[model samples]
Target chain A: MKPGTGPLLRVAGVVPGLWLAGFFLLPLAFVWILSFGEKQGLVAVDIVWTADNYLRALDPLYLGILAKSLWIAALTTVICLATGLPVALGIVFAPPRWRPLLLLLVILPFWTNLLIRTYALIAVLRTRGHVNATLGWASELFGLPFEPLSLLYTNTAVVAGLVYVHLPFMVLPLYATLHRLDRSLVEAAADLGAGHLRVCITIILPLAVPGIVSGSLLVFVPALGSYLTPDLLGGPDSQMIANVIERQFKSANDWPFGSALSFLLMYVTFGALALRSLSVRRPAAR
Target chain B: MTEAVRVGGICKRFGAVTALAEVSLRIEAGEFFALLGPSGCGKSTLLRIMAGLEHPDQGSVFIDGIDVGRTPANRRPVNMVFQSYALFPHMSVRSNVAYGLRVTGTGRAEAHERAEAALGLVRLTGYGERMPHQLSGGESQRVALARALVKRPRVLLLDEPLSALDARLRDEMRLELVTLQKTVGITFIIVTHDQEEALSMADRVAVMETGRIRQVAPPAELYEAPADRFVATFIGQVNLFPATIGADGTAQAHPFPGVTARARGIGAGRQVWIAVRPEKITMAPRGGVPAGRLSGVVEEVVYRGDLSVYLVRCMAGPDGLVRVSRANAARTADRLPGPGTEVVLDWAEDCAVVLAS
Candidate 1:
């Protein structure tokens, strides 16, 4: 960390740098090279440069899936923001002794495997699952007729599963920002004749925009490219773009098209992040 | 003068710590008052209570003769400038100043005009476009003041307003605050532990200690005739000598057996302290005429630009050390006493205030 330690610093970076070059960057370079190639047969792809696969991705059928994926991801991000905000605030304002426990609960889900977590969602949302079974028991107790609701294997289920997994991503950053926020500013707002709602809308939200930006990106990107949740919990009509990419590599046997699709999703994510940096860096007064 | 704010029998406790204990004060309108004390002495807590940010456990706060004990801070007719100048960091200085007006539903044009006027009052007219983070510490402080003053409340509370500023800036702001108070003619209640800040600006000061108001008096009275040993020492540097009162309305001073000083309103034969400010004592050479019977060698001399403090160690004993401060007159620039110089210390009968030991 001291000055004139440049050689040591460069040496420290060599291990991770080589790791990335070998495992991550090289594989990504291979994918980029493969994306320009033409599919020869069931197994191999010719090294001929072609834009045909990217052109194929522009088809209306795949476009519709991509659009649906964006909508679902956007909706999931919005819901996460709404729900995670209150939870984060609650944790921040809780007694100091209780805060660690509350934060642990938020992070506890990450310890378990994501695939197993998605399966756990299946038990709660499937037909004759816990929610409907509880409702049906209540109906029987009340002597009212009822039918099991089709809750799982739908777009609604996919959104719910996404929100379930991504809520912590939203809450953690929000919690960090809210925790560092000066409580005196809120008190100052109240002292200056601001009511509770006005203080929140005028003072709290604007200050929290940075956290919301990062949290939304954290939830939206993963939700857009989500594979396990939609694959397991979504119905036949709920095929997201990730599902299409998976089909291209597996049954479709078109590695070039899959690589192109993956890169396309990456481009959208990067574009959103770039746009955010531009707006966040703007120095103009609002 | 009309009463601006009054808190009656206020009592507050935070867990085991008693922040305020049956404290009460009546502040007059258009008067600048101060609550002065050390940190954690409940001055800021009492200010917050008056601002309606805090509620007392067993008391009522009256504003303009109406008991608004239960009113929230937002509903109260008072504003506070915080110690840290808690301006909204996300807002521009203009919006920060106009926040109270805008939030309370003032028209946009009117709010903007009044906010600009407030900014002008603080002498920060063209700095409104800068964000809170963009401004310097003193600028942020003025923005906070402008923010609160724009609301035009009947009472303005400042909690340690100048503590964050450097020495020269604090002196400048003390004068500005006094001038601003007279311009607006609203009651200004400032809380500070700096004796100079409280004494210089406040029309009257309530000196607090350990959650209790020890004395409430004008600046001159608090400085010249302190109510107790604590105020005497806290207001400025003072030399306290333990003594017993004589039957002739004079205190029998210690160590120097021949010295006795007259003090008013104390029973005879009681232990007391003769409290004299360092500036009050005059220094003379050893064996000089009109000097006290006692004499000591100058132990140390601290040279301040305007004045010099001399610590004289009397020949009587260790308990006989007396401190004297003299103004550095131009005539004696070459002859100022240095260390190890033999000298005599003397004070007038009126210089000492007698307090119970």
Candidate 2:
């Protein structure tokens, strides 16, 4: 006879479930309660319930940071998808022996620390860096005078950094999905008079939506809350919402306001993911 | 009638393995043909070559007298039903059936109308809105058939179409497929490993082994006059006895001391094998051995509901069992002889076929 799932599952789930409730849910509940309180002196909280923190977070100055963050994250996601989709497809369709090596190359960057990798990008992008030095040498060899271009410390550099870091997040899911696609379905479509473009549009693209949704969520959520890349690479005008939140907690000593801002980001991210999952589920149900 | 598909001197190799070796065959415009072989025998490869899914390394394929060796699969006049059915999981039944028409730029209304007609022909008219995953295995196969037939292709290729279904559904679909083919009146080519499917459904079958065609014949001729030892044994169960031909045009083999059967196409003193089907041999009571009969002892009896199979140990043969099958026509207590009983077996002289390979 089989063991009953009731008591056995409850016994097995006790440790991890209690661990999550204690360390994760308890802190989140405290943060929610703290968002409504007032901040007193440094590291002190006063129990005066008010809506002032949320009101201040809705100001045009803070809202603009949020919008800018969304724009940058959206752009980064688009660029990653445009580049990652082809790379993922290539890996899935590559010769059997070369596939593992190519996948390893995609993941090799993760072995290094992300902060260290971003700092290394500065050497390639700075004026008189590797790129400018190469361009200057090529111009001089051609007997043409050239000036070193300022490639770092700009919005472009920030976007490039975000895209570089998030590209693998987009590629891995797409590879998993495309690899699971049946090759016979493509052959059947071709046998039914669909050319290569039609096969991609009608079959491959629609079937790959789950992967695209997952990859977009993976890239977008982290990008929206990112602070390091913008601070290290962007100009003062390119500040995002996360930079503001960081300043509120560390420099301004405003714990309640920072908590309120964090909740807002969480709510918006949750709403977007919920909407995406709903859209994905409807077609599958039909 | 003009040939619908003609493959000439085709050869295909996959790295180190040769899939097809200078293979060639012609299919008529409306005939049901089958390529029958075991796994790795290159029947599927030849079917793919005809569908333009795989290209031959040498020679050419002509559909309706137009050389299609350079044509891509989408542009070819042939379509295939894959082994897995390959239905689009996301699409509705209507959309799946209409996919071919829509891809070729047919108008939306026309494509839908033709798709509905195709569905009705397959008796799944009310299942248009259902997803592919909602259908059973047999329904999925019919939808695949409807999808291919909507294109009205010059030739239809089925790669093990019914291999995935249960036994009852496979038998039903076999008849349905034959009726569908006749109603549509287009050429159909199927690849299968089941000898029974090939013999029962195809108007003609090409038996293949090691990338070469052993024989191509109708069902009756293929069973009655196999070309060599492979076709003789591959088509059905046969009892083979190693023997030699005498100068008097007679075969001398074990269990039959005197020269009993005559064979053609062999010189005297040449080695050969005589083949006879199990059902062709008649079993009688003990001590009933006639002048040309062989005697044996029944070692095992397998009683199927419809027939009884007896494994007999031949007293004079080279230490092998000769099987005999008898139909259970009447329900009687002692209709079949029990095991360990002595029996005499004899077959008509013309029933034995001599193979010299």
Model-by-model DockQ, in order: 0.78, 0.80
Q: Kindly report the fnat of each predicted structure, to 2 decimals.
A: 0.89, 0.91
- Please report how far candidate 1 places residue A241 from its true position, in Å: 1.3
Model 1 CA deviation exceeding 4 Å by range = A1-6, A137-144, A284-286, B246-250, B258-270, B291-293, B315-318
Candidate 2, B236-351: lDDT as tens digits: 98888888888997888855573256887689898888888889988887774564367778999999988898999876445568889988887983867999898888888788
Give the Cα-based TM-score of candidate 2 against the true structure.
0.93
lDDT of 1 at B15: 85
lDDT of 2 by residue, A162-196 (tens): 99999999999999999999999989999999998
Q: Per-candidate RMSD vs. true structure?
A: 2.2, 2.7
Cα lDDT of candidate 1 equals 0.90
What TM-scores does chain A show, candidate by candidate in order? 0.96, 0.92
Report the error of model 2 at residue B245, Å: 2.2
Error of 2 at A197 (Å): 1.5
